[model samples]
Target: MAILTLGLATAGSSGAHPDHGGGREDFPGEGVADGSYKQHDGDEGHLPAVSRNVTLVGKAAVTNPSGAGNTGRVADVTAFGDYAYLTAFREPTCENTGVHVMDISDPAHPTEVTSAFIPTSDGSYAGEGIQVEHIDDSPFFHGDLLIHQNETCPGETPPGANSGGISLWDVTDPRSPKPLAMHVGDFTNTAGGLDPAPNQTHSMRMWTNVFDKKTYVALVDDEEATDVDILDITDPRNPVLVNDGLDLGAVFGVDQAAPTNLTSVFSHDMMITKVGRRYVMNMNYWDGGYVMLDVTDPRPGKVSLIAESDYAALDEERSARGHEISPEGNAHQSELSPNRKFLIGTDEDFSPFRIVAKIDSGPHAGTEYTATPATDSKQIGEGTTISGAVTFVGDACAPLPAGTGTALVERGTCTFQAKLDAIIAAGYTAGIVFQNHRDDCLSQVSMAAAGPIPFVFANRFAGLRLLGVPGVTEATACTMTTPATGGESTTVKSVFDGWGYVRLFATDVPTKPGKAGSIRQIDTYAVSESQDPAYAGGFGDLSVHEVAMDPENNNTAYLSYYAAGLRVVKYGKNGIQEVGAFIDEGGNNFWGVEVWKDETGEQYVLASDRDHGLYVFHIDC
Candidate 1:
């Protein structure tokens, strides 16, 4: 039987180091509806008594070719002088995905103003976040200079590998936003050539320098360090690349891997806080923690690694107490206070990420308290065997003879891990998982170490079944007859199938907003001890991925998970919660999220669902 890998929480308060953390004053404030106390030190005690009046603000369904698998995966969101913008990309198929626009004049309600295509079908834009700012040109400035990352190659067909370039949008009017320029310059001419096998860019940050009166857009190129590309957007229509002779790292920082043109690393998601001539760029990581870069000079600028934090070693004692982490990369997304005092890093791990608050500014800032997982708490599944050999479509185990070896399960039928975990929990150690049929021909496989046993994965259950009896090396050369048909089982077609992706979900909703008014009251829809073949959820027991707050109200947030559709959460006092979930009956899935505010303050949510195009919704009584 497989053992459960339940671990501990985060470590306790660290001793008084030199205290190089930033100050609370500089951190961005949530801007509570009422004059509630705002304490940065990660302390919730100093705040005043506030009732959770959060109500469901509704959601806007986003439709696109990528379908339901891409909901709530809304990568990045930022509010500028007078607008709120969102960005999305294609997954699975990696088709035509681009930057979308919504006017958030009214926080509660949002209007879809425009959506400009990224000007290429080479690969999905894979755009994560959006930023818009007006230059000093009054009426002429009507055109908002928008910047975003393009992480796909420029000429490759969809459903294959992805390459990318950065995109610039010209949103002079709310109704007709257009693309002004696209800078694929960085990847346009490498030694391997512009259309380098994997042509793409990852997470990017854009900012306007008050000192130089220049607008800069920085993007991290997957694989290599020095992947920071600087673009001058002085003119909204035309953009120029400033930083050169270097490499653009991955959006999520470098790890024990080589830099690739189409991988994510370095700064997955970052924020550019302007403090005078100096700009603070907080980059996320693979293991490099959060690095603060000093980009005062756009040209020939210097980058430095300021601070680093690692959850990999938060001892079982510390983890069990409260800290729990998934094997995901560190610092998925981060936001900065308007003042730039505090930096909030949201680790995209399955569990909650530690919210590090910098109390005293300038080289002596003290760090303070409070840490919670991103999703609701729940007991993880143990381990079990999974099998994809029985093609439900075929209604029979492969033509191969039924054997006594452990079963290798494929991911498509239901929640990827749940099935395997069930097998282990029910008393099986050697489980094999197969790739989804839709994946073109490439598969990303990993072994989930449930205690001491091994959980291996393959392109199909047939592969695992072959490995079961040991010494079954030449899988392509062996054949066996099935019970019904006297024919031999089919051979393994492809090893690198395109169907594997890491699915994560929350354990349970926070009883309280853990972070003051920003806490989202979670509705424990229903917990199950085993995977109901009928339900066939996603990876985690729930199958959902990430949770995001209403752009305007922290209490109101959206939940996006595959098969679960989109869930609108409302947090209230004394444990108030409600869910407005729109599910897909035909296997559609959700993965990303972003709230676009219309001119009237009304909020509109955009989500990427697999098979289901982008879904748009609203939160009103």
Candidate 2:
């Protein structure tokens, strides 16, 4: 771990942030409605967020032209020249879910370039993984390029709903998008699934490897072992999948039955840039921490690990709340500094609170458990009384027999939500689904649990322990085909832990192209209220989502801090220090952040507010 330091985060009781205002984290395509809205409550909910040296230049509300309503339907965005392209999120009309181009000539009044709207398939949507890149040296194509991930909307499929994989378009002209490649790397939805979907393309980045004189795209496989994808896009029209399903566990040496310091491990987001002549990729794999790879070749077998970060047994954020607990892994999104000296990452924990259980009566009784809320459901009441009675078990992939209690199911077979649905029909109130295979054998991953039902997504050992299978350890391999067995009374109880925050890695530069380096963890940062239990209950999410480096200065990093608004921090020899912040009147729910420096070299921070549209801010101080 690197040198640890606490950010000058504002506290929960300070009245600087917005009231929870009954708002909940609404995932893009899942569309889980916030059920906590209270009527006529207080002034804090509508109060203007505290502003420091940041100034709002202009704003725009993504609207539905059909008038059906498109409130908060924006996800990721990218900027090039005087225009920016935005991705649609859970659009009111799923069919119309596409990319919107914004004319930013007049930063004070940026408007959507409707004519440039790049729509997806008939019944699908996009996620937070849209990127625009310029392949300066590629011979196949010469202009600006855009790539997007297509995900099928929740519920029924609308006819030939062919979705999944990455789509490419030439956006040299913001208004007239020329299709270069459509759904090039899609995968089947199920086993031997006929209709393919681009479900795994959660977050991706493109770059031109100077060493190879070619271009490539590295994307996340959200739910599969083929987690890291590097597509050769030297020919914009015909992309080649250089590497398929490269499992992190197999490559990182943490996936096997060894005891890993990292808890949750999966590729989520990535940033690619150059260090001298070497091309490096900084990947944020949940609890696996930040990993830097030498991707100079941008091909399958050619990639090699350069460095991986380690987490503190009790990181700064956890200790902020005075808890001696370990860091809740969420290494979400990150990028190395332009100077190639350090990397800044944001750990997004929508559900700040975590669930840790202990074996109550077995030989392994009193042992600590690895757990995280699989569902974003309502809090199971304040002081933690075990909610339901009895416990049932089965591999949740199938419809289990009726059992009116908590359901203990195995992972895989179907979606987490589908498993919950099956158990609910069988009268189960909550779920405890464990890892069914090696890919997820020992990790505690956060789920896009789609319903109101609460659930606990556990590691493989947790499931076996509940089934009364003794001698289970981190090294025990899981049987993918075995269904867990347990009566409605397996011994277990739940307790809450601290929220998620941020990590800072000090860069250890590699020598040259295809060389290796060690990127070490030097420190961690989070908003003061993030670890405060008082803010955990409400005030929206006090956690940071995404960040962008100031093109004007590498030490300056702008953060899209959800309910706490936009935060401006400067990283120095000591650590990161917050310099400014902003939350609009009525509060702001910022999602994605991007720094755009126009031809004039003036840098603007474009923030996507989940409740509102987009807000452009400039760091004045």
Candidate 3:
């Protein structure tokens, strides 16, 4: 068996203090109702709240606190030796547009080492993905290399600007990182007419093997019909393209299907791990679930597929949920356990809902309804029925006739909250139900405030049924029901919504010649036991975003539970157990988490909050 070991060395400590940068903020305002918290202007003094064992040792805002477009929010972080590299998702026009280098010899207070940005003439930026590795023994180059993804949004590329791809930097001198190479993709020609908007790299990883005597980086092309792009970086100054693109469907005999949720066939993220002597690449193929590839022989174009996960059956089941299918099941990202016995995968479902509306009374009585709760509508109680005369209000975007009936039925337009407010002011008290203006089904609606009365939504077809009911007029009485139990109330039942959860898979490495190993589904972990009223009948309040396994302990996995904060879980012969958690009271939209060790061999959790800045925590368990 090939036992792969990561050769990481600890660096001597260096004491340094934080330095503040001064400049006029560019881009948009810090906070503009982007669903997360408003950016606190010049509030770098704010620190993340933590549990008893976890400490807020070091804190720094990479971007100008007064700027806009994710200015102060740190996107990702990577630790190597005594320094930590952080990526920020700020506007291209901002001064701090690239990776922020921090001297972490002193964990309590990380000092700014340097700031590095991609060398571009048209004012490009870098931040999305980053990885650092030592290549001292390589024949072509020897030193520390920092690789980061250069991502551009659709139609945001400046004329004559280099297309998005990967950028390599030599950080041997932590205080001054020098550019090594810039690799861009060909956007003019894309497979299956897939649009490579903004032409950029979505995610990437660097890998090296002593026995193979080669180093490579895998890049994900975030365009339709595009696949994984592999590059040989043995010579950091001159990266060679080994594979233009590796189409998993064509190579592994797998077929593509229509996306049910947010999942697609496009490659989102990939991780290369050494299992024994052989290296395997586990890819999170959006809707494709998890795919395993044999990259042991990563010769320019000789990679082979070991096994690809099958999610067609799962997709069929999700499609059966009708138009209200939750977005919880789309495989967004994944990570393998330290022991290599299990693979932890996460589905990125940010917008979730738990709305249950049923038709009460009339010919359609007893018919169950799937509706979205108004962003600002008040939560209805169990056994609470709103029965009143049905009155049709014109298109909600425009001014409605004065004093429309109490139970208003309006067509969706503008904002759900705005429509509700207008009707309520005109004296509509019982409730409101908005029908879809488009022919397509209404998936989910974001209501900003819960109005004074209950509110529900229906698709275009359901609206038609309600409008055509016989004997139904402004005086016709209809009722809406909320479950009596299981939801927020003792009698109210919670409705299921969203498609975010974690799944585990197991793989056995081959030990002898002519012997083949097997990969199969093992166990799964979710927030099903959550007692939070918000996720009652939904997919739970915790939408597992990304996971990082403890390097020292294979059984422990740290998860960035969006909204639920950080969660520590352990899995082994005893099954999965919740070991610890730290939920920031201020609110947490954690997108990434990494497990790093200090010189004393103590482990710590580094998390990136999409709304706030970076958070450092010491795991007690």
Best by TM-score: 2
For model 2, residues 398-505, the per-residue Cα lDDT tens digits are 767878757777665466677777887888766776666663365444455655566665567766766666666667745534543453233233323444566677
Q: Please, what are the lDDT tens digits per residue for candidate 1 over residues 20-96?
A: 10101111221101101111122221112211222334234333444544433233444443344545544333454
Model 2 weakest 10-residue run by lDDT = 8-17
Ranking 1 against 2 by TM-score, winner: 2
RMSD of each: 17.0, 6.9, 12.6
lDDT of 3 by residue, 1-621 (tens): 321211110010000000001101112221111122222234232224446445556655454433564533456678787777777554323344567676777777766653443333234455446889989768888899999876542224344545467878898877778888764443434433433433456678989965677898888764323377777788888777677658776666544442222223456688888776677888877656677777776653567666666543332223333432333335667777777777777765443433334444456554434444443456544544445445556545565656634444554435555667677776765445544433222222223445767665544333434444444322222232211211000011233344356666676655222234556666666654332334533222356778888877778888887556788888775456666777665556566788877788767788776665566787777
lDDT (Cα, 0-100) at 575 in candidate 1: 31
> By TM-score, highest first, what's the ranking?
2, 3, 1
Residue 350, candidate 3: Cα error in Å is: 0.7
> What TM-score does each of the candidates earn?
0.50, 0.81, 0.65
CA lDDT of every candidate? 0.39, 0.65, 0.55
What is the TM-score (0 to 1) of candidate 1?
Answer: 0.50
lDDT comparing candidate 3 with the true structure: 0.55
lDDT, residue 184, model 2: 64
- In model 3, where do residues sit more than 4 Å from their true spots? 1-56, 69-72, 91-95, 114-127, 183-188, 191-198, 224-226, 253-263, 299-301, 311-328, 354-496, 511-516, 528-542
Cα deviation of 390, candidate 3, in Å: 22
